[model samples]
Target: MSLEIRKIVRFEEETLIEGYKAAETPLRMFAVAAVVKNPWAGKYVEDLRPIVREYGPQLGELLTAKISELAGGAENIEAFGKAAVVGLDGEVEHASALIHTLHFGNHYREAVQAKSFLSFTNTRGPANAPISIPMMDKNDGGRRSHYLTLQFNINDAPCADEIVVVLGGASGGRPHHRIGDRYQELKELGHDIENPAAV
Candidate 1:
C-alpha cells in the first residue's frame, strides 16, 4: 500500500516580547504537519508493520525537509520534537505507530545532528484538534530555556479516517527565561550529574 498524503500544513510562532520584556533575540518555533489517510482506521490490525515500516521513514523525511527549510537548515534548529493526531475513528495506537518508531525520529535527530531523543505526543482527536509538539534542547533535555511547545491546528484535518503527523523545531528558546536547568536542581539535591535519574 502507498502512503497517501492529503495535505501539508506549516506554521511558525515568533516572540519578540514575552511577558512585557523584549527578547534580546526573537524566539521562534515551527511545526509542519501532513494529513494522511489511515489504512486501518476502522479495522483491527494486529500488525501495523507494513505501513509503519514503509511510512515511518517517508513521513520523517517529508516533514523534516519542511522543518529544515523553515529553520533555514537543520543546523539552525536548536530544539526539536514531534507529535501525531489520529482521527476520531482511528486508534491512538495508530498515531503512536507512525511517530514512536526509530525510523521516524532518527531522521530528525540525524538531520539536526542532535544528541537528545525527539520528544513526542500521540492522541486521537477530530478535525481542528490541538496539535502540541513539546520540545527540548537538541542536545540537552534538561535545559530549561529550550524547553518549549509548538502548537497549531488545521481547520479540516484527519477526517474520520486520517492521521496528522507533525515535526517541530525552535530557532531559540523562551525569551527572558529565568528558571535554571534541571541539572542545576539535581546537583543541589545531591543527585549524580552523570546519571541524572539516579535517586
Candidate 2:
C-alpha cells in the first residue's frame, strides 16, 4: 500500500485581546483539535474507536508542542484554561477519543507550579461534543473541498496573557494537485485558468 500525507488546506488566525482582563489570577482557556484521515477506519477495521482512543494522546502531544511554540514557552502557560478536541466529517467518534487525549498537553504546566484547567465536551446527551468550525470550498466545475476548524476560548483569567492555538488536518493525495505549474503551462498554451478559487 502507498501512503501519502499532505495538508490539502490550512487556515490560522490569532488576535491580541488588548483590553481583555480576567477576574482571577491564573485564568485562561485553551482548545485544540486535529482533522485526521483514517485510511483503515470503518472498513477493514473491526473497531476504530479503540484505535482512535489510543491515538488521541499522541495527537494531544503534537498539539501541545505546537501551542507551546506559539505561546513562546511552557513557562508562559500559567493560566491554563478550557481545552477541547473536535473532528470534521467522518470523524465524529474520533473527536471523543481526541478529547480524552487532550490532557496530555497539561503536563507542561507541572514544571511551572501552575494549575492546568480544562474541559472536554462530552459525547453523551447534554454533554455531546461540539463540532469544530466548518470549512467549505466550491468551484464552478463541481469541484469542492471541505475542512474542519477547531476553536478555543480563554475565559476570566489573568495569569496567562494569551492562549496558543493549533490545528492539524489530514489530507490524502486526491487533492494535492499543484496549481502554479499547471497555470503557467495553461497560460503558455493560450488557455485562461486565472481566478482559480482562492482557497
Candidate 3:
C-alpha cells in the first residue's frame, strides 16, 4: 500500500483589498496539494482503517511541511484547513479516508498549535474540478474572523484512480473583521464560554 505521488501543486494569495478597505499588509492564504494514486480505487474493502492509518502520517508530514513553507512558517499561521478530491473511478470514501483521520490532520494542527479541528471537504471528480478547504482560528473555533475558505483547482489530476490531498494555512484573519469576537457574543448572551452547549 503506497501513495504514488504524481505531482504537488501550490496556490497562494495575498489580498490588499477586502471590499473597499485596504489592509495595512496583505492577508496571506495558501494551500498545498498532492496528487497520488489511490490504493483501493476499485475495490470494496470492508477494512480501510489499516490503509488509512498507514498513509496518514506519511501525507501529514509531507503536506504540513509544504503548506507551512508556502504560508511563510508554522509560527506565522493563524488559521488552517484541509480537503481532498478522488477521481471518478474511486469511491468518495477513498477521498475521505486520507483526510478524516487524526493521523493526518493532527500533524498540521500540532505544527500550528491550533486547538480547533481542521475543517475539510471530500468528493469525487474529474481533472480540474474545484476544491475548497475550509479553515478556522487555530486555537479558537468560535473566532468568526478567522473562519476562511481557500479554493483552487488542479488542471490535470485525479485521473480516475488518483486522489488530491490538500492542506491550507492563513497568515492572518479577515482584514476587516467588524462582527466582533466569540467572547463578545458569550458576554452579551450572558452565556459561559467554557460550556457552550448551555448557551
Candidate 4:
C-alpha cells in the first residue's frame, strides 16, 4: 500500500471573521486531507495492521507541523477550526489510521479538544467527492472496525494554524499511492473543503 499526503491553503475573509467572533480572539480556519493505501482491501493481507497503528502517531505529528507552517507559525495558530481526512477507493482501513492518529490526547490535545474530531467510513468512488462527517465522541470506543473507505472532519480547534495533514501508505515492502492530485482538482472546482475565513 502507498500513502500520499496533500495540503491545501485557502484564504477566506469570512472564516477569519467567524473565528474571531466565536472565539473572541485572532484565529484562522484551514482544511486538511490525507490519502493512504487500504491494506485490507483487494488482497487478503495479514499483520499489516500493526504497520498502520505504529505509523499513525508519526503521521499525525507530521500533519500538525505542516498545518503550523501553513498558518504562518505556531504562535500565530489560534485554532484548528475545521478539518477533514478522506480515504479514496481501495483504502477504507486508512480511516482507522486517521482516527487512531487524532484521537484527542494522541496529538493536539492541548490545542484541539477530544470531542472536536468527527469520523466517517466506507467512502468509495471519486477522490474529490464532497464529504460530510457528523461530530463524534472521543471516549466512545464502541465503533466497529471494518474494511472500507473512511473520512474525518474536525472543528473548533485552537491549533488550526499548526495542524499538519498526513497521508501514509504501507512502509518499505509496499507500493505507494498519490491521492493529492484528485484533492487539488476538487479544490480548484469549488469544493467546500477548506474554511479560510473561520480564523
Each candidate: what lDDT?
Answer: 0.93, 0.35, 0.90, 0.36
Reference-based TM-score of each model: 0.97, 0.39, 0.95, 0.43
Cα lDDT for residue 136, model 2?
Answer: 20
Worst 10 residues of 3 by lDDT: 190-199
Off by over 4 Å in 4: 1-27, 44-48, 75-88, 91-93, 102-105, 110-125, 131-199
Candidate 4 weakest ten by summed lDDT: 168-177
| Model 1: residue 10 alpha-carbon error in angstroms | 0.5
lDDT score, candidate 2, position 90: 29
Global lDDT of model 4:
0.36
Quote the lDDT for 99 in model 4: 53
RMSD of each: 0.9, 19.5, 1.3, 17.1
- Give the per-residue lDDT of model 3 (tens digit) for 40-83: 88778888899889999999999999988887689999988999
Q: Which of 1 and 4 is ahead in lDDT?
A: 1
Tell me the deviation in Å of residue 68 in model 2.
0.5
Cα deviation of 53, candidate 1, in Å: 0.6
Q: Please give the distance, in angstroms, between residue 41's alpha carbon in candidate 4 and its true position after superposition.
A: 4.1
Query: For residues 1-199, could you state the per-residue lDDT of candidate 4 as single tens digits?
Result: 3443333433321222332344233223333444443434444445555656655665566555555555455444322322333333334443444454443224643333333333333333344444332222232222211111213333321121122233211001101212333335546776644552232
Tens digits of lDDT, candidate 1, 75-110: 999999999999998999999999999988899999
Worst 10 residues of 1 by lDDT: 190-199
Comparison by lDDT, 1 against 3, better one: 1
> Considering only N, C-alpha and C atoms within 3 Å, which residue pairs clash in candidate 2?
26-159, 27-157, 28-81, 29-81, 29-82
What lDDT does model 1 reach? 0.93
Clashing pairs in 3: none
